[model samples]
Target: MSPLTTSSRRRILFVGEAVTLAHVVRPVVLARALDPARYEAVLACDGRYLKLFGELPFAWRPIETIPTVKFLDNLAKGRPVYTAETLRAYVRDDLALIEAVQPDLVVGDFRISLGVSARVAGVPYFTITNAYWGPYSQLPFPLPEHPMTKVFGVGVSQALFNLARPLVFALHTLPLNRVRREYGFPSLGTDLREIYTHADQVLYADIPGFIPTAPLPPHHCWLGPVLWSPEIKPPDWWDAVPEGRPIIYVALGSSGENERALPIILQGLADLPVTVIAATAGQPLGIKPPVNAYVADFLPGAEAAARAALVICNGGSLATQQALAAGAPVLGIASNMDQHLNMLCLERAGVGARLRVGPLTAKQVRKMTERLLGDAGCRQAAGRLRETLRDWDTGQVFAARIAIQGGDGQTTATQP
Candidate 1:
């Protein structure tokens, strides 16, 4: 165990890679939940989403991440996200922040640089990630909409992807492994799962039993979903949603393929009897909504999900978790691997359906929405999961996990 500061509080430094909003938002939600009295938390992240947050309870440090557009493009192309040079720079920044904070424990959300920096700094590191990314996971890997999928049809593309999947994942690990060697550490091998989970402790941000996996090691633990919604006011049309017709809530999130799919969703649901509520995750939709649809740049997501009969999204964990927490069935039009993996778990759980974004049609969206809205079994599954989610006290669970390292005292909040 690492030593606490003179103040006797366990200093925890949280680093989030702002490559996407979900990465930054997950850490912020967890950092806010810690008991300020028992733990001293300092958040180091890119300033892109800082304005979306309210006044933070703990200290804040500015850090740098690759541009979101570049990250997304690389993922879309199925290429290595970080170059060796980019990771080297990330190590420099991470070490500087670690030295400044002098934290006893480090918690990171998708900031892969810390796999090297935290070990170099001799601190206990815990990483927040999804269960599907774990080596123990039994989830199937579906071919994402990459170059191969376009050049060849999905049937042939999927076959090619399966044969090349191991090599592709190995390529993504090369940059991180190169940086580890620079830090005088052994290479983490060619397995991308090992690279993502190379920390002292691995914390999964998911519901237990949702994703099938082999028996986990003692160091790996489920932290549950770190749910968060923007604290913004609802649109002028929030209360006017009629009760006679079913309500459908659609959100593509910040990193979701929103620009391509939102317009089709609006047009497809236009002729239906239901009312449509959509949040653009702050992007300009450029397209007009149907008379039955109310589109906004942002909305308080939790309330919207609770009010909706069905939730349509990009099948990422953040939005899907929101819908599950509200007892709303999901209709995920997934584009990337992460979103596809998440939707697969939801499908197995019987609370949602998955549609490929590559061949998505407004007709398909309307058909799935109609099916989920009428599926009583799906609704019951969501409601049961919602009750389970409500019972998970994420803040308390987190505090308990790290308390043994230092600051082993009663967990109490000071309203940060």
Candidate 2:
């Protein structure tokens, strides 16, 4: 493929790994937010969440992604999610897509194969990722729940984890490095951070200063949070949710073990002087909803979050950002490392609290919910953070980056 000339609008391709909804949603949202006149956007991903997006302005192409069950199981077992052979297959598919789309630049959210595919195709690549995964992150890594954590207590497991985390991270980088070596590229080194961020440009979908990091490379910059919500309509009970009491919105998301957690959440808040609105993410709710709680399979997250006095979720960036975007305090019931890392930042920012899923209890949820709902400080912090998020035009920043990369060298892109 020839280089794109200045006279033509740049064609940008976005590839999202469909292992989780957040991965697919981030890229789709960014693609939707682009300046159509200056950029031709194409999105390629598995069709798991496409129904939620409704009609799109840009072109959509189908692609293969590993099963979500396999991905989550790997995370739970502390195993690397991808294998050398799996990534090798992904590279072939990505290259085929690159040939078909012929994009001037490629943007990926958790589509790790692009690290090898884009480079081999001689295309510039940009990655959308959280700051906590970057090399410069100053936040501590809490040991995720693994077999070791269950065998040994958290205290002992955490200590062992601290001692072995470096080795474990290196091991996780092997599959990607092996694929890179096959493509005649040098190893991205043993650091998983470097492997994940290996691209021509890296965009962090997070608030500035919310997570401390060292000085970033010029190509690495904040694009702010790419906030997106499903297009699902509110349940019939939405209007009927009582107005006088505090409203607590609950959505544990897909990555965590929601089956066990949802019951605890409902039980904890059963007698509280609040209204509970929970989204079950389409999973069957084995137990009945409490009198004060309303249950649904899906909810428009942004609107649901905006109306809540408190937001509870899986502690992943997408849900937490949704709550913080609405100026609502959060109580994260986190299970995975990604969730833990994200929740750590929110906790440090004083806008939220994090509780592990392993030992979650009704009493703990009630205590945390009462504390967050009653504490003026949590709401105040969330309000301030909401203002900060408002100042960051994520779409404009991303468009400006594309403009500069396409030789326009502009700080902002004009939108229609």
Candidate 3:
């Protein structure tokens, strides 16, 4: 087939959650992978991610909408909370965005409501999630903390997770149902748990060690990690890192929980010997780094990871993966369900360690950092994972799959 004659472009819409840069970053990589002649991609996310997407060539539509809401009661009590009203608003806005875009295929990165909206609109929908979120997922191991919350000591966390799973599903569904009725869309009859299981394609971004899945649905695809690069230029100081010492990069994703946890992290890493480069990302914790630490509002994760000896973070998947790709071990202090789960996966893979935020102290941080730096095992394991990552072209692979599904025909295009 002639190249020009075989290339076909299809309009694609990406609905991302602006709660963190990871959500936006995943889609951006996928967009870059897409063939310009075979796909015209537009991103729908909040204004905060605009700068993150500014350097991309594709057109962007800012959707000043919330695709999910944390329950205030949950936040106040330091527990998982869900509200019907919040879900309703999220679904409503998501539906509106879908209607406005009306693309051939809709891609949702952890934005649950968008899948439902696409389904209702009779559009093909795809989503990326960890295997932990899969229907048959059972926690493979114990949580580092919260032993009391465990059920049988054999995956007790998993058991309790199973126990509360129904109620949590209801919490997500009630609001979506309310919005569906309000918007004149037919009720799905199923709850949120079942709703998540209904996507036209469900891509699990995690590797096998963390979440072991068997006999999954035909729509399920495990595409591994989708690595990303930020468009923002690194600060002038980035070029000046000391030549001999290994660098340690730290950044928390844009989440309220992360903002609250930053002080604890700053206090923990204060006396570490490694050269630390911290990306504040607009969250100020009122702590100054030592002369060895480089603080900036943002820097490209890919670049930082390439130069780092280790990475300290709130367990954002994209950041962690980038570090691992660069043969750097990670120390993760996570604050939310997804972040905690992502950290657990990394730990299970033997590439990182997780520290609980509650009862966190400088002593524990110092100990963890010392262990990671002093021992060569962590770095060796990270290097091995990096080799595996280097073997796969995740962005191009995922984009090719999408192009095939959308019937766009450019299966061999080189991804950016």
All candidates: CA RMSD in angstroms?
Answer: 4.0, 3.4, 5.7
Better of 2 and 3 by TM-score: 2
Best by TM-score: 2
Steric overlap count per candidate: 0, 0, 1
Error at 326, model 2, angstroms:
0.8
**Cα lDDT for residue 6, candidate 3:** 36
The reply for model 2, stretches above 4 Å from the true place, is 408-416
lDDT of 1 at 30: 87
- lDDT string for model 1 (17-125, tens) is 9988889888889888887776778999999888778788889999999999899899999989999999999999999999988888889989998988887787778
Alpha-carbon lDDT of model 2 = 0.89
Writing each residue's lDDT as its tens digit, candidate 3 over 124-237 gives 777877777677676543343343443354256557756765675566566556565665656655445445544677777765554655667656777777887667888998
| Tens-digit lDDT track of model 2 for 226-333 | 788888778888898897999999999878678999999999999999999999998888898999999999999999999999999999999999999999999999
* Lowest summed lDDT window (length 10), candidate 2: 407-416
Cα TM-score per model: 0.95, 0.97, 0.83
- Comparing 1 and 3 on lDDT, the stronger one: 1
CA lDDT, candidate 3, residue 334: 61
Which candidate, 1 or 2, would have the higher lDDT against the true structure?
2
Model 1 stretches astray by more than 4 angstroms: 5-7, 407-416
Candidate No. with top lDDT: 2
lDDT of 2 at 378: 91
